[model samples]
Target chain A: MKAETRRLTRKSDHTRQRILDAAASTLANRGYAGTSIKAIADSIDMQDASLYYHFESKDALVLEVLRTGVVLSEEAVNAAVSALGEQPDPIDALRAAIVAHAEAVLGMGDYPRANVRNFGQLPQEIVSAQMSHQRRYGKVWRNLIEAAMASGRLRQDMNTRAMRMLILGALNWAPEWYKPRGELSPGDVGRQMAAMIIEGLLATGAAQPVRRQKQGNGR
Target chain B: MKAETRRLTRKSDHTRQRILDAAASTLANRGYAGTSIKAIADSIDMQDASLYYHFESKDALVLEVLRTGVVLSEEAVNAAVSALGEQPDPIDALRAAIVAHAEAVLGMGDYPRANVRNFGQLPQEIVSAQMSHQRRYGKVWRNLIEAAMASGRLRQDMNTRAMRMLILGALNWAPEWYKPRGELSPGDVGRQMAAMIIEGLLATGAAQPVRRQKQGNGR
Candidate 1:
């Protein structure tokens, strides 16, 4: 009985994965509006009825795609955070987190694009689910910001909520323009972004001597 | 003859304006895929054929909508830059430019959303035209960054291209989550973003003080 149950579970998981892969590809290529049930079915070499058997509706299929993307993104963030466990320097950890998150998203390529483009097409329940996951993601950054603040490495005056929003806004939207072929790797872009936000454009006291000299002369 | 020509031009302009207004509202509410020529025409109480007379197709209508939004955005940025005329503080001028740009896009609301959401639907020629306008838009930020660098207000080592991308990325995508009813006004959000990027997370020279205090306590 136990062996039979294990076999059934594996088969179910494989079928679900196949359905999701088919949906992601169709949604990416044809877009939400351009894609239909029949097209997704044709791509997977399944009948339209079979596709329905897996997903109740087109919206359900899209919802599943979004859920999967968010889950994958969350997992990547969690892994990066775990890798930085007990690190005294929150800034370094945060930077690592940013780079890892960018790689995970860009690594998926068209999958991320489809997720963004079809965001509005998601049902209200699915939108809420994604938002819940996002809130969890936000907490990860917030905790890092708070940790940095506690360490005296970061400014006390900075609003952590706003800071998180700015960082996430910049990072989340990066795939829109960031090409892997560019001079900057995902890691480079991530570090530069982290530096710009963490160290800032202004010449702080810790700024190198040359930069400080320039600031002094300007004053 | 000149007066007759002016009259004809004025009539044509009015018709064009009408089509754009209808398109913006329709596209914003119904989305790109959901909007149709008949709907836009009906919004103006014109026949579908009449809308066709003005626009070659639904694609053309969307293209005009995008074109007009870009032109208006550029005009707003130019007007803001002009207003800053001869300001000695490039940082202040840059802040004003960012604020103006954010307000302009926020003011357009649905129009800008339509432009972003419908980008893939645009004809190749139209897409190139729109991108040209974007390149011009980018110059406004690039000029400000260069000016700030020359003024010594910003760090010399900062990559202006990346900085421009960061600033524009934050501001250009504001319509996605920025709410007028939120804690920050559009201008406030712009100012905070600029401050965070330009001034950085730490107070000037505060890092050293904190570090020295910790060392003194240890001793």
Candidate 2:
């Protein structure tokens, strides 16, 4: 609340953001075994001690990096779907959300990529925290899926819960194969998958992308 | 071949199969760090020395275990598609293949499950060998998807290569959330996904199962 305290808080927040960015890049390029506290600190031109002063340990830092991506993914998907506004078909909302997710993950440079690559390798101390965020993320996707199914726009007989997992798995796995400059953009890849999963690739009638698909949706 | 040599060859093959089977179950249950040559040997009541005689190293053993599942998946999907006969519909063939794959990965216990669970953690030496089999496996799925697209059954506008990757990603991720004895059988999960993917959930008019869908497609 005081002037000096406010200045310190702003600096602390900036330092945290810088550390996250550096760690995300390092972990993405180097993977779990190759990434280290010193490497991350060096990336940001900060001392290892200073880095630790802001975060407790390497596990704690890595967890924060992962949490940042998951939280961002959730918020981005929510925003994409909500932007659809009233009278948006449930199926269309789901597709836009999928595109939004794919872009957020692929478009955001290292952090989400690292989360996918090193997730299975993270120490339990970090992974447990990351998993909580992941579950919450899953919950949001599940709600969208349930809404789509309940609206009779998606199949009711099929298990929506199982379908939700498969859909997420498909989208989540995009980073492993998605090339930023490849044949298709991330939004294109997401739309392709959403059409395949939601509409059945068998038909030519997959739901059209909302005309107002938000800008910056492509990786 | 001489009778004595032929008999010995057959016995050697049997022992190799036994060792591979034991290794797959152990790795699936205990994970990479927890699994060892000694533990695999113990599971099958063989001396570690004899196990070494067959596998050379833990990496070799794990690689063979993974290869077994991928090889099985390829064969099963091939058989399913081939059984569709000369005039079979492409969508039906793809559906049957999807069911075959799901049953293989999620139904048959630990080998494939281990391949999915511990793939990211496996040492590069072991993983490199496993990946070759995976690529071959991918080729088979790609062919099916391409055939369906070429037939104008699946949407022609979507890229088949990208579609293949997304389809497999969803199916492969099944083991992470699938329960062997859950509400849906592995066969059912496969069928559900096949329908959701190939037929699109929005259509109640999608092709009904070919009733003659290959008998005993389940594990």
Candidate 3:
């Protein structure tokens, strides 16, 4: 009996995965407004009624797609944070987090665009679940920022919230312009983005001269 | 005779403006894919055939809408750059330019989104023209980065191309999430964006301390 139950669980999981794959492909091709339940059903070679058996509505299918995408992103952030556990430096932690985020978004490709397009259409309960997921993801970066600030690696006066928004805004919008066929890979772009934010355009030594003035004045 | 010519020109201009206004509203409401010539004409209380008197086809009408939007954006950018005439400080010039840009986009509201969505659907020539306008507008920011590097204001080793992309990417994508109804005005968001890019997250003094050891350390 236990063996039969385990086999049934595996079958259920496989069917659910197939449905999600079909949903993502349909969403990417047809967009939110263009896609329909019949199209998703046909893609998987299932009767339209079967999709209803699995999902309550087209919105439910979309919610499943979004949940899958968000979960993947959350995993990437967790992995990056875990990898940074070995590093003692706060800057390294921050850098790792940014790199992980860029990779996650690029890997997901059209999923993020679909998320942005369908955000308003999502049911309140689903939207709340997604928001909670986002808030948790955000805390990872915030923790890194706070660590950096506490360690004097980043400036205390730096508004962490605003910085977080800027970093996220840039990374999230990258898919619109980033082409895989282009010269830079997503990983390269991610590193470049992190470096630009961390170091900025000012020469490393240029600010030192200004800093000496305060010390000299004190002396 | 001059009065007759003036009246003819005024009527033509008014008709053109009316068609563009109708097209913008239609595109925003129905999206680029769903919008039709008849729908635009209906919005303006005209027959579909009457639309052809002003525009050659649906594509032409859409192109005209985009063209008008781009021209307005170009004028705004030009005005901003002109305001910064002979300013030696690149950071200040960049700030002023961003403020002007944010004001123009916020004032235009849904027009920019419509422009971005319909970009691929536009005729190649129209797309080229819009790109040319954008490239020219981008030069203002590029030139500021060059000037900052030429002066001692910014680090000479920094990647100006990447820096420009970073700043412009953050600024351009603001229309997606920024609500004018919020506590932050468009102008305020623009200023904050510039500050985030220019000043960076590190305390000004803290960034300079490590610069000497990391000169030419491009990622």
Candidate 4:
């Protein structure tokens, strides 16, 4: 390729990344309905036409930002679990995934945070566009939970679907209250949550030990 | 009071309720930014001026709806716990509160769901105005958790604050995926969540049980 063409391509890619960064931060702070293309362009000091040069429309740009969010979080979870070598304990892998997810959404950057914040407030078309990414991410957690259950360590009496939702719900809600400068790090929060979820709040062998015979499909 | 005056007062109150109902459903579905005063007025076929007469502005209208949401959930939790009567088991009371909260947010109506959905997207001033009610509601859970802990039946090593936040997060996130017509009722979701939280996901006497000695406030 010609030297000038190569330079132009690099500059264009940089511009696209800048636009995405701005869009992500906007979407993270203000939700989907609150973000606008004009505001995004203005934040980056780019003309609307130039912004459109990179992306077709507001939905398309937001779609890419959200898609990146899911990818980033899924990658974070996969990396954390993979870091635990071959045939690691399923419970430890689950804990690592939880911490990685918390860090991704809380400390890593705005892309994952945007996905966490906007899950329920998107247009039907946007939700449809993001469904596959979300489904794939869901599968990641499902597998983690299933692996733990298969190890015969996790309880079998509860509904696994509800368990997954509850775990993700707790982790996803971190962005609402997590402050980077606060006393607790994302990992700290995740560890505490994982402990509470694994051991529960009940004191073992205490008064009112309510354990019962395993019930069928308790949901 | 005169009968004519009383009749007019009743009619005004009824109209006020109609406006609030429309506002709650719209806010729950569309979120704060997506909901407009004009759209809310149009939905109920009320003039914009009439809406303004009932609520000074969009923020004022939304503020009332969210206020009702917190109040309803708090009341539900309070009533559920109160039904246990004096000297009831703290764990039982906590379970009742959880079930009531889930029912309020999931099955009762849109007001609580609106509060759950729009919590992170509200403007600063609205958040400020609602802080007292939220704080009061927080205190209710804190007291319940404290009661459970005092009974020496709950874990002493975990952070109580994190425990409350995780429980609320899991419950509050129900609006995102809970279908009213689905197989699980609100009470069922709450019961399953309570069971998972109180007993945890660990199988009793399973491999890799990670119980530890009492440690310093493990935040």
Lowest lDDT sum, 10 consecutive residues, model 2 chain A, at A210-219
Residue A181 local lDDT, model 2 = 65
Query: Which lDDT tens digits does candidate 1 get at residues A34-82?
Result: 6678877787678887765556677777777866776676677778778
Candidate 3 runs further than 4 Å off: A1-19, A25-30, A34-56, A86-90, A116-132, A138-160, A206-219, B1-59, B116-159, B206-219
Candidate 3 residue lDDT tens string, A1-219:
332345445556677678878787666544555567788788889898777656667777787687766667667767877876676577777777777777776656555545544433344666786787656766877787888888876655445665776787677666556666665656666777777677665566643221111111100
In model 4, how large is the Cα lDDT of residue B12?
A: 70
Query: Which consecutive 10 residues in model 4 chain B have the weakest lDDT in total?
Result: B210-219
lDDT of 4 by residue, B60-173 (tens): 889999999999999989999999998889999998998889889888788999999898898899999999999999999999999998888888776678879888999998
Best candidate per lDDT, number? 4
Ranking by lDDT: 4, 2, 1, 3
Cα deviation of A14 in candidate 4 (Å)? 1.5
What is the C-alpha lDDT profile of model 3 across B97-196, one tens digit per residue?
A: 7666665555565565566444333435656856775566667667867877777777554457767767766665565556666656666666666666
C-alpha TM-scores of all predictions: 0.77, 0.79, 0.71, 0.88
Deviation in Å, model 2, residue A24 alpha carbon: 3.6
Better of 1 and 2 by DockQ: 2
Single out the weakest 10-residue window by summed lDDT for candidate 2 chain B. Answer: B210-219
Writing each residue's lDDT as its tens digit, candidate 1 over B111-164 gives 665665554544456678678876776677788789887887776665777777
Interface RMSD of 1: 5.3
Ranked candidates, highest DockQ first: 2, 4, 1, 3
